[model samples]
Target: MNLKKHILALTLLVSNFIFSQNTYVFLGSYNLDKSAESIQVYQLNTKNGNLNKITGVKNIINPSYLTVSPNGKYIYACTDTKTPNAGSVSSFEFNPENKTLTFLNKQTSGGENPVYVSVHKNGKWLVNANYTEGSVSVHPLLENGTIDSTAQNFQYTDGSVHKERQTRSHVHSAIFSPDFDYLFLPDLGADKIRCYQFDEKQKKPLTEAKVAFTKTNLEAGPRHFTFHPNQKFGYCIEEMAGSISVYKYKNGTLQKIQRINTHSDEIKEGFASSDIHISPDGKFLYASNRGKENNIAIFAIDKKGLLKNVGYQSTLGDHPRIFALDETGKFLIATNVNSGNVIVFQRNPKTGLLKKTGNEIQMENVSCVQIKKIKP
Candidate 1:
């Protein structure tokens, strides 16, 4: 109750309150086949791991994957088309004051069924991956946050071991290296991770990487990829074979070092594995499995860039397509596409384990989850 002590405490309380009022999260969904809102918003409680719905952005359909600009002033979504061989990417200007997204424009994805979209680090380019047509496209971004013309579209023409799913090329993910100097495109149908050197200065942003590409198991369908915090190693999750492939990365060359199973026990064929992400501290890695077992598998990362299976956690829903950690690494949210809900879990940073927070959002066909920190 001293005069100076009370003033200092009051200032700290006000600063903390201001920070709490500025955190938000965005959810993207596949609302075409279900009765749910599209592009919903939630406010994140900084003190506790809970989410509160703020508002929902309407008029967008099948925004399966979402990305935010480097400056956090724009939002990009893969707005998929129902018609076969048609896909597009949409950009919107975000108003942080009101947490409203204003649609800017859409650009043809240059391929079919775009499953992923990302904004380049330079803030001048956008990248998208079309799954059905097995092509990766790069588009230019206007200064006003709208999309310009597509700069390049490269198609992959090859098949792997699977007869049903690998009969043709299927590009699943396009991820940039930690340094932003290279692009890694994982092809499910081809069972390969194609590497391309990404130079923003060139007329064509992408060229064949120095090492070209690396092949996974014969029938392994690679779905997603992630890089370690040290930038010395890379990890990729195989969708068809339910495994993880770790590689040593240097100067655009990937040398496979180890391959491990995401699942503890081998199940029958036709199971699916999804997203992969490394913890911010690079101490742990996580992967999602759907099909038979709907769970998130956890792994511990050793000092030499290897994964040790820790355990698994049930997602509490079916078809866990995607999940994301908050910017602070305090919570993890998993989006179950088929079950139409998203669940939240509090993180134990020391142990790299997750505990269910018992918070869930009932979204229709939730496809993607993104965490956006609001400005003060």
Candidate 2:
């Protein structure tokens, strides 16, 4: 072949390879009936916002909440089931080229009904919240991204007055600070946000005077909390009372600055708030409201770390359990459980508003949405 022709062919090959790298949407499905678990995976076209199911129509038990590893090579799922004992967390190696998952191993979560799991920033530890046991547990991550045995477990023993929801302490979610120095456990039943001294080097939790606790409104039932990427502020979604509590963090202490109702005054019926998240740029906050409300409440974060109501958008489905922001901060996906679908929205970066993208991916009882980038 001529030199010019060979160069042109190589360029075309590179362009084709780049175009083939697919963005994926992974849904964690829940099975209230059997034990065999399944997670749905779909290939998403970034150019036109189209989703095609690649594989994983089968069932996987209890992968209700999921988090991708820092390297984006592994995906960890919190199976909210108690097989012989309590539920456990599992790891899966991801193949970005083919959009498939390979199971690695599982570790007992050291409590019951493990709802959420997150990896420490250093990638040295994995933390989980056990709802039924009302506890938080830490697991060491092996060099290959699998979890070691449970190293440390802390059980919360307090409860509040919401008879149906807060009868006992239920730790719904645990997350690390941006600096990875401390861990925050939001216990729904206890009406408290428990701060723990995290030892990254030792892969354990320490009981120390550094512990700080913040109180939520009685019967508020704090579910999931997310910190602003800048680490100056935090937000928590109260499940039972359907409210959002804003907090300011300084020197390892969290001070409650404001609490805002997630719903309008006209809708007085009780609803359950599910997940809370802040945008990557810290300009907006999003919370999911389930039950009859069935919408995502959006807020604008002011310069002073206070939230001003932006607006609310219906998830366009039932039981909006969890929603996630894409890596580019350009799109948001809401997992509607009862409706068995995930609705996509295009995010306006400048205004921090979400517009319906008219893209809905069908699945079964999807409780959580997770995204992983396809490597080149």
lDDT on C-alpha atoms for all candidate structures? 0.86, 0.82
Shift in Å, residue 208, candidate 1: 1.3
For model 2, what is the error of residue 173's alpha carbon versus the real structure, in angstroms, after optimal superposition?
A: 0.1
Candidate topping TM-score: 1
Task: Give a tens-digit lDDT track for model 1, residues 141-251.
Answer: 989999988899998889897889998889998999988889999999999998999998876889998677888899899999999999999999999888999999898
lDDT of 1: 0.86
Model 2 residue runs over 4 Å out of place are 1-22, 32-37, 57-59, 80-85, 203-209
TM-score of 2: 0.91
| Steric clash count of candidate 2 | 6
Candidate 1, superposed: residue stretches over 4 Å from native? 33-36, 266-268
